[model samples]
Target: MDERIKEFFSWSDLFDYMVTRQLSHIRGNWELTWDHAAQEYEAEEDSYAELINRLVIELSELDPPLKYHDNEDRLAEYCKANLNWNIHKIGARWVGSDYASILEQGGFRDVNAGDLCLAACGRVKAALDRNQLHFDDMEEFHRKMLADVVAIILYHRSDQCITKLS
Candidate 1:
């Protein structure tokens, strides 16, 4: 709807707005818990971990294609590793952590995984387009490019997405 929001929906924009928004919602919850626990020292110190764990689970439930064992592991590792730590640094690093590497590695040659991921990305792009989330030709193309990339990734992994192309 908004231009800034449109910019974020671009695949070439370097961040997935939907995912970012979801993460932000999680962060807001985490902050609320942190504040609550800070005021109540006797509060369970494990509350943050529990919240993160739940968020990770929730994120994994978004789309079957996006859901993976590695997704849970990566999110858990990030929550555990960065608890009570620097928010900015953790936020920046969490995105590029083993979660993606794991997805890339496992999705390779795995038709189910690749197809799922590509489909999930496609759904996201389509939703964005329907919501008027494009800034220009470049942005529109960017979403398509992401879809293409996912398809290529699927092809590279298992020749499923590009059976005819290859």
Candidate 2:
């Protein structure tokens, strides 16, 4: 791993910003929606502990590495420093099979980080809409968000597959 890349991105911070923070917001919304039966929302932290650890470990091992950011301005600075100007074309490897299906199903392939975040939010909405508030469903929701975060970072910083570990 390049020292520069390591200095710029921290998987733990990104996980906290994207997954943990988002889950907190989602739980708040769930509580508001469920009202009297809010306890049914069951978004236990234990549900995502293993998944988050696995994602961070897997990401840390990627070749050429990727990045994560909690700040838009800082991320933009990193992108400007590292990526080609006016050419945001991402490498093919960033889109996994499931993510590909998601883009295709949505009838669009061109995506920005915001789009990916929205897609992840959609997963949560779907789970809640169906009243599938099980821990398994919440875990899946977090998994999708984490995958999208990986895709977003890899889109900017890597052309290698997520499975291409060093």
Candidate 3:
């Protein structure tokens, strides 16, 4: 019912799927892993962008529109600038959910399937070492990356929800 909850649940298969990617990579099938993520993005185009755009508008208009709010414009620009390049391009491979953090780290490196698989190895190791099976990093990655992807993949499907943004 809640928008954030809906977003959270939208990627219910993320963790396990990441794990699956890890195993496949171990088996020397890294391309398969990247392909899965790429397909997911192909399925994404413009849908999630519309969702976030609406959210920014809704939140900004809570009280007759906030004074210092141009979230809509900013989001639009974000979509235009970031999403313009399709992930399906030659060097635009899926670099796992962790690549999402590279922005905050000021490390603008391109993450590929190998990087994702290696990160998977680390997460898997952490789980085996009794760390909390956390997806915080991945979740943050989803927020930034998916929004960017959707924004780039423009479409007019404005009134639909992948699940329900209610």
Model 1 earns a TM-score of 0.27
Q: For candidate 3, lDDT tens digit of each residue in 1-166?
A: 2233223323333432442233332222212111234222112232242333343233223322231113222333333356552222124332322333322121122122222222323332333244333333344543334333222211222223452323
Pick by TM-score: 1 or 3, better one:
1
Indicate the residue-level lDDT of 156 in model 3. Answer: 20
Q: Each model's TM-score?
A: 0.27, 0.24, 0.20
Poorest stretch of ten by lDDT in candidate 3: 104-113
Candidate 2, 1-166: lDDT as tens digits: 2232222223232333443443443222211111134321123332333333333333334432122222222333334344422322244222223433343233223243343333433443444456644323345555454445443433332222232212
What's model 1's lDDT at 132?
41
User: What are the lDDT scores of the predictions, listed in order?
Assistant: 0.35, 0.34, 0.29
Minimum summed lDDT over a 10-residue window in model 2 is located at 26-35
Question: Candidate 1, residues 1-166: lDDT per residue as tens digits?
Answer: 2233323322333322322222333233222222233321112321222322232233234443333333324433444454432222254244443434433443443444434343444444444556644423334554543434333342343322111211
Candidate 1 Cα deviation (angstroms), residue 46: 54
Find the number of clashing residue pairs for candidate 3. 1
| Best lDDT among the predictions, by candidate number | 1
Model 1 weakest 10-residue run by lDDT: 157-166
After superposition, the stretches of candidate 3 with alpha carbons farther than 4 Å from their true spots are 1-111, 131-166
